[model samples]
Target: MLATGLTFVAMNGIVRHLGTGLPAAENAFLRFAFGLPLFLPTLIPALRRGFPRDLWAGFALRGALHCLGVIGWFYAMAHISLAEVTAIGYVNPVLVTIGAALLMGERLSWRRMVAIGVALVGMLIVLRPGLRALGSGHLAQLCAAAMFAASYLIAKRLVERTSPAVAVAMMTATVTLALAPIAAAVWVPPEPWHYRWLLLAAGMGSLGHYFMARAFAVAPMTVTQPVTFLQLIWASLLGTIVFGDQVDLFVILGGGLMIGAVSYITWREAARRSPITPPIDVAKGA
Candidate 1:
């Protein structure tokens, strides 16, 4: 999980560096372009044997939604401090818990509700939108989180019917193809320096995803979800050391409440569900 966090931070650094020159949509497309080759090795096996039509649809929808989320996220990352963006992004899990209850008809317990409420309080601490109010960077982070939550909910449905590897590969392929035309329309000649940052962005993204895939393979959702929360800590550290970003007391307090809330929700979910083997939860950026 720590590896995942760092790679993603590295990815943000690369994106922030590159977005100064290129369009965000184009940068994201380059990421998928570089990433496309990586998928073929895993995709061939999944293709020899096919999944149901419904599963394919699920894969497509999840990928499309997530691609938009990534666009929003990359745009946000380009403008914000790592900690500020990431602190706001932690709300994705809370969004996921609510999505599960509403869309998937999962049972909602009072504990989960309270946890979400507390987490909201944490978010308010981080945002403080009223006095010395919200800025564009912060708004972008919040939007990214909301969009990512939508993707995860769609993904939960997809994973139930297909392997995570196949699902991931297919989604990457679909979104890559989806972005090709847009990238072509806005394509600009790239500088040598731009390619370096773009390479780092793409590499970190691919590597971060690889670790995330491995983390999911090893543990169930109940186990892995909490591990992913370590992002906030790493984000803060990176922000301070690398960029000299300020540490807000609200961030610590709010993030603590949010993490505690998510932990509570996960615990309640584990207690309610059967002990049968199931796929792990895959959390991503807001």
Candidate 2:
């Protein structure tokens, strides 16, 4: 999870860099196009096995959700500070947790409820309503976060039934196909340097999603979600170092609160799963 967070932050940084003059749809299409090579071997075998109608539908839905997220993320990163984008992206985990409870029938304890409440407060602290008018970037990021959460949850379930490689390959292929028309409509031919950056972004995203799928396959969402907060820290640093963006104290504080809430929720979850020690059977021991 930590590695996934680091790679995702790096990818997002590259995305922001490449987003400067490129339309978001084109940037998104380019990402999947470049990443396609990594999945060709796996995708080929998966397709040879015969693409069932249901499988195709599932992949299409997943791809559409991811495509929406990629477009929003690209647009937001181009217009807003990376830290702001990352902070807003934190909402993904919150949505995932709720979705798990409501849709997947996962248990949601009062402890988790309190944690979520704290996280919501953190979001308010970061956004600080009325202090500044909300912009397109913030709205885009919010939409991206929600779509990403839904996509991730679907991927997690799909991973249980399919190989991670196949799941990722299908998503990549579908998203690439879905974005083609939109990208063509707004396409501005990119410079060689832009392709280089975007290609690297695609590589990082491919690696990140592979690890993410494997993680979800091995663990429940509750077990893996908290570690994502690390991305916010990495993004804040990247924004400052790479883009010369200023770090606002309020954002840090809010992020800290969210991290704290996630940590407590994780701890509670772990405690629940720990083996109970049987009372010492001193009376029975001879």
Q: What lDDT does model 2 reach? A: 0.87
Question: In model 2, which range of ten residues has the least summed lDDT?
Answer: 277-286
Which residue pairs collide, candidate 1? Answer: 144-286
lDDT value, residue 97 of candidate 2: 83
User: Distance from true position, residue 268, model 2, in Å?
Assistant: 3.0
The weakest ten consecutive residues by lDDT in model 1 span 277-286
TM-score of each: 0.83, 0.93
Candidate 2 segments exceeding 4 Å error: 275-286
CA-only RMSD, every prediction: 4.4, 6.8
Write one digit per residue (lDDT tens) for candidate 1, span 1-286.
5687779877876676565477667777888777767778878878788877877777778777777777778778777777767778878867876777788776556876787788889888888877666777677677778877877677666655555566667777877877778768888878888777776677787777667555545444334545567778877887788777788888888887788787776766668774533444444311
Predicted model with the maximum lDDT: 2
In terms of lDDT, model 1 sits at 0.72
Predicted candidate 2 versus true structure: per-residue lDDT over 59-147, tens digit per residue: 88999999999999999999998888988898999999888888887667788889989998999888887998889999999999999
User: For model 2, which pairs clash?
Assistant: none
At residue 230, what lDDT does model 1 achieve?
71
